[model samples]
Target: MSMPGLSTGTIAARLNRMPITRLHFRMIVALSLIFLFELGDLNTFSYATPGLIKYWNLSVSSVGVIVSASFFGMFLGAWLGGWFSDLVGRRKALIWSTAFYSIMSLVNAFTTDTTELATVRFLTGIGMQAMSVTGLTYISEMFPKDVRGRYLPESPRWLEIKGRSQEAEKILNDLETEVETYLGRSLPEMRDFEPVQQSAKVPVAELFSKELRKRTIVLSLAWIFVILGFYGFSAWVPTLLVQHGYSVVKSLNYSFIISLGAVPGALLAWPITDRFGRKQSLFVIMFIVAFCVIMYGLAFNETTVIIFGFLTAMLLQTQTALLYSYSPEIFPTRIRSVGTGFTGGLGRLGNVAGGLLVAAIFNAFGYAAVFIYVAAAFLMGGFLIGIFGERTAKRALETISK
Candidate 1:
């Protein structure tokens, strides 16, 4: 179980070696902060929309446009970001992406019409996902394959033809170069057979053989639940708080409180996931989140509102922390990004639903119903994770992929 060459500094140096470090915790902190700011800033659009409606004479459809702009950009960004980050170093891609969103957020403040908002939001989304996903891949490489951390949630590139755009090919090339130079293996030595697809699923069954399929499915389900919890909470909580009779100020304050709590969850999740185990950590988080989300909806006092508001983040956001780390752990480096990207990007379907569906539930069924729905999603996530998820704490990364 014990290897002779692993050292803390070695890991740290690997993680922070400009493009990729072995265990660059500081870079993770830096990346997390940039992401938190972007998420916080992006959510502001929801609050900003009404004011924009009056000022710009925007239509109801325009509201939909503003919200969806970010998503459309994000899906594309996931592919491009992974390609870009893999092609360039994670650091430069991140620096540029952070600056892109920072500029776009300010531009969003000045939008005079729906088109402008959509344009700005789309660009902002590009920047946001590009930075976030690249950071995810970057962080994953730095840590030991067996180690994982709280993803505090999130995807890559392909289908384009340019040298810079061809990430999958580039990655294959990188693997070839790294192997030939370091280990004296040719490209043929590292090539894997393409597994047959069964519908839209990963055909993880074929890729790794039947024995591993059960564990792979469990890992996939864990990702789905984590995302569902994150989206379900973020989407419904504000309206639910309003339905519970809180003032606009109270609702806004509480939303900010929960988001702020996510900051610490993001910072610590990676270390916790790596040290403890992804399944065990997520199990703990899901219960805390389920309990708090229930209390946030049902409790009426000001103090209880604030306490549970912060408490809500204990796990809902922690879903993100674990997801980023765990998903990649389940695949090989060649297909790791593809595997993780598939889940993270497809999961955006849930995110899009989160923005619209929960609003409908509140509009039609009331806050209590929404609370019940969110609670069910979280509890189900906990149950699914406990039952289906794999333990990636100290296992090798290549093993997960196989």
Candidate 2:
């Protein structure tokens, strides 16, 4: 049965019917559902990893490599999903990715060994960013120009500008400064930010052209480690909790507590990120997450465990708010979803890598070692944000993608 999909004109016409901001409301449902689904989807793997390993007698390296397989699918899907979404529209991608992953998730339950499991996960990853990229762009489309044109008045632009008060100019300056600052520190200053510059008028074909190889590199670096870190720790949380001498019920309970934290955290991320800027907001959250991860590892008392666990959830959930809010808003309307899918898809590579990384360290080093590794991942995320991420508060897309 097909439900009527609204045209942009139709949607725009009915804007008054929406009780909340359509963009926010769409993201609230779409991103939140995807987050919850992926959490459960990844957790299903974690819960089943041990069983699969024992049943199949798979080696750690084998599982690690197998785990990464899903990323291959996600990589293709993410980079391409945006294009597809732009070509068709935002809504289709969401419905398709969600439907695809939902079905693939069930398929995972029937897996035999690393091969079959990876295959299923791979298919699952193909749908990984369906909701993410499209949902992001939809938000950008829904908001008022006032929301788009102005940087939060008090928001720190990535670079300091003197005397520029025009909100759009301020935003452009912020984007430029953030790009320059990141390139100044991390990248060789060999090439200036042509992509960032051209974003103002660069066409999608031009943005994705051979001339802009550097842009692709910058984008890849943006999402990889941070994503890997977040997913790696999360994928193993249920397993780690179980290994902490907690029963399955307790382990599930702990994970539930963590997920619940993300709900409020997600809400917090939108306004704060909208006001402060993405890079700053992310760095702040990552720092606190690092601390929470360490606390989660050492805490033994029930109260301490639950408390730290909730903190971890808060940090993780904030992604739903910031990542989704930020991703699509950074690209052109034509290619917004594509850029989002690509980056998000690239992030899933980290998820695949994290799964394997945790799997490798789990038996060899111990849960504590695994978590420390996770903490290191978060630390890298913080470092990367401090170095590369621009403050994106009050900034809109249309030019950021190029």
lDDT by residue (1-402, candidate 1, tens digit) is 121121111222222222222224555577768866877775676555444555677643455556666666765566566556545455576677778878877887787667777888888777777777767766665443444353211111111211232343344334335444654433222121222111222232343456545645565555455555565666445545654676656777777777677667666675677678877787777877888878877876778777787767655556667766666666544444444554565455345555565656766777666666777777777777777777677664434444
Model 2 residue 367 distance off true place after TM-score fit, in angstroms: 2.0
lDDT of 2 at 78: 77
Candidate of highest TM-score:
2
Which residues of candidate 1, in runs, are more than 4 Å off? Answer: 1-26, 46-65, 83-103, 145-225, 239-245, 267-271
lDDT of 1 at 286: 80
Model 2 per-residue lDDT tens digits across residues 1-402: 121222211222222122233334444565556667776776567566545545677655666676688777777677666766666555666677778778887887787666787788788877765655655565555553224311111211111111212432443344445544645542222211111121222144644666444444445565776677676666567656665577767777777777678668766775676577666777777878888888887786888888987888788768545655655555544455666676677677666666677777887887677767777777776776666654455433323444
> What are the per-model C-alpha RMSD values against the true structure?
8.8, 12.3
**Prediction 1 global C-alpha lDDT:** 0.57
Clash pairs for candidate 2: 78-341, 78-342, 82-337, 82-338
lDDT of 2 at 224: 79
Model 2 CA deviation exceeding 4 Å by range: 1-40, 43-66, 110-114, 145-219, 243-249, 300-302, 399-402
